[model samples]
Target: MQTEKVTQHIINWLKNYALNARVNGFVVGVSGGVDSAVVSTLCAETGLEVLCLEMPIHQAASHVNRAQEHISQLKKRYKNVRDAKTDLTPVFEEFKTEVSLEGEQAIVDMALANTRARLRMTTLYYYAGLHKLLVAGTGNKVEDFGVGFYTKYGDGGVDLSPIADLMKSEVYKIGEYLKVPGSILKAAPTDGLFGDDRSDEDQIGASYPELEWAMQVYNEGKTEEDFTGRKQEVFKIYKRYNRANKHKMIPIPICEIPKNLK
Candidate 1:
């Protein structure tokens, strides 16, 4: 898709939604990654107040710096770029001391990583309430609807997802079209939960392009026909995470008696 049309579509969509909800602006967690960079630019183009938050733990200095750089460039184009950083190390330490955390170090690390995501979400909501801004999710279709590579109530919790329909590669295309900083566009995508070297592809063992291809096939109602190589691997990833986190996507269950029983 052309950058101009996509940009206009996003602006029109947000404007209508903002007016309907009586919102004054939009807020997004800028991870210094491509997805959030594109989202921030799109939101800013709508002439809405776009607040970008950089919530980093101890391991995100490099990513945070890149995010700041992107935000700086965005400010030149959009007047509403503001940043706030909240370090989550102290909060994680306190929680670790309170709870008897058991399991391997990997498990502990995963828990800490999830804590950081939930903290970011909480901070976004707090600002949203204060500013009457809609929380814009930066997750793309490949991650959100395909592999489900997100926390249950962490980054997954959002008022709206602007790029939910675009794949990760498509998100990069949009970012390039919007003239996002080359430093951000070229940076290896990571969640900044572990060290700077850790990445989602490292954890999932699949590339975004491959994941999106499998997703498109599956969405078109195709079954797993090939049982070899990356195809099988992608299927396993899709099934495992989808089945494991099914509860995350559903509402809490409740038991009730029939009204006539009374």
Candidate 2:
């Protein structure tokens, strides 16, 4: 994939985008995941002001530690990089108190998980506005396009996505090249939204490699019927998520009136 060339391309793209937009730099929500680590590092490479926000809401200890470690290393390596931590636990608790938690337990938990993401999104935009920075997205191809595994108006809310076109494996490759903290690079991927130890594989029922394979085969005009056993199961899982989360992958629906009606 011409790793060095790809890395320079993204860095130049980020630099040009920020310059064209007249923004100082970028603000990225670092979650200690490979995606965020790679993204934040790329933004730093642009040699512009990059703010990394660690907004945690009932986050797991391992996740928090990894996030801190990555941020620390980034700040040390890049003079333009700085970080801030906002403990959103109290804010989240207050929000829960104001809202009714009436519904199925699973549904309610899911909603709260999304709320955590939205809260971080809000915090990111707040800093972006204050610092004249663009909100840099950390989503990769599989999550952003293949599975739609992000919260709309939440983590999906961003001014620009630097890694959306790269697959998850590609992102890891970039992470390794960028020298991201070992703890983060070795950790299993999770959204950290549920405040649990469950990995993204647990939630999606498929690993990134499996999903990438399914995405490729599906895009190549292969159907679930063409596979059997585990492959079929993975394909079905990918298809289900793609269908269910199509709303996130496409433009919002708008009602268009007929000319006569107008």
Candidate 3:
């Protein structure tokens, strides 16, 4: 892909979108992941006000360090870029106290992880509203469309997605081009929702590259039965997630009223 052209295209698109919407700029939740790093950099390139919020809730030290490093570099490079760190750990703990943790252990743990994402989403939107900025999403094609690896009404909540069309590999390419912090580029891809070192591959059972290949083959009308061994396993994993999380990929369903009833 024309890397330079694509970079400029996304920057122009962001600038136009913000101008058309009459918003000052964008507010992105930087998670020290390639996706967010690329996105925040792209937003900064628009030369508009870019607010990078580091909202951590029991986040791993490596993740926090990488996030701060990227934000620091971004601010140094772009005069329009600024950052704010909001430690949501206390808020998260207080919330857990109010809610019943009654459920299967695994299920409860998953719910809490998603809660961390939702809290960050709320924080991003709060800043967006306060400063007349749009909430810029950092999701990529594989996570946003292929496997649905993000939380609905949480990380999935956003005013606009600048990188949703780009695959994970493509996101990394742009990250490299944008001079993203080396620490973030080298780190394992993770949601950082579980507050652990578990990577996204650990949760999905498939790496981004494997998922990207599966997404392509599946789109071209391939099925699990067509592949053998590990390919088949990856295909099945992709299909399972794509089917179960279809709700996140589609518009909210509405019950249509009958003509006579109206």
Best candidate, lDDT-wise? 2
Off by over 4 Å in 3: none
lDDT of 1 by residue, 1-262 (tens): 6767877788799878988998988998988899999998888887878888877767667787788999889888878777666766787678779886788988888887788788778988998998899999988887787777888679998999889988888889888889999988888777776755687888887778777777777767766665577797787777676667667666778778899996
lDDT for 207 in candidate 1 is 78
Cα displacement (angstroms), candidate 2, residue 165, comes to 0.4
| Sequence-dependent TM-score of model 3 | 0.99
* lDDT value, candidate 2, whole model: 0.95
The residue-level lDDT of candidate 2 at 126 comes to 97
Clashes of each: 0, 0, 0
Give the Å shift of residue 72 in candidate 3: 0.9
What tens-digit string does per-residue lDDT give for candidate 2 at 1-262? 8889999999999999999999999999999899999999999999999999999898899998999999999999999999998999999999999999999999999999999999999999999999999999999999999999999999999999999999999998999999998888789999999887899999999999999999999999999999999999999999999999999999999999999997
Model 3 agreement with the true structure over 1-262: per-residue lDDT tens digits:
8889999999999999999999999999999899999999999999999999999888899999999999999999999999998999999999999999998999999999999999999999999999999999999999999999999999999999999999999988999999998888889999999888999999999999999999999999998889999999999999999999999999999999999999
The model with the greater lDDT, 1 or 2, is 2
Alpha-carbon runs more than 4 Å astray in model 1: 250-257
lDDT for model 3, please: 0.95
TM-score of each: 0.91, 0.99, 0.99
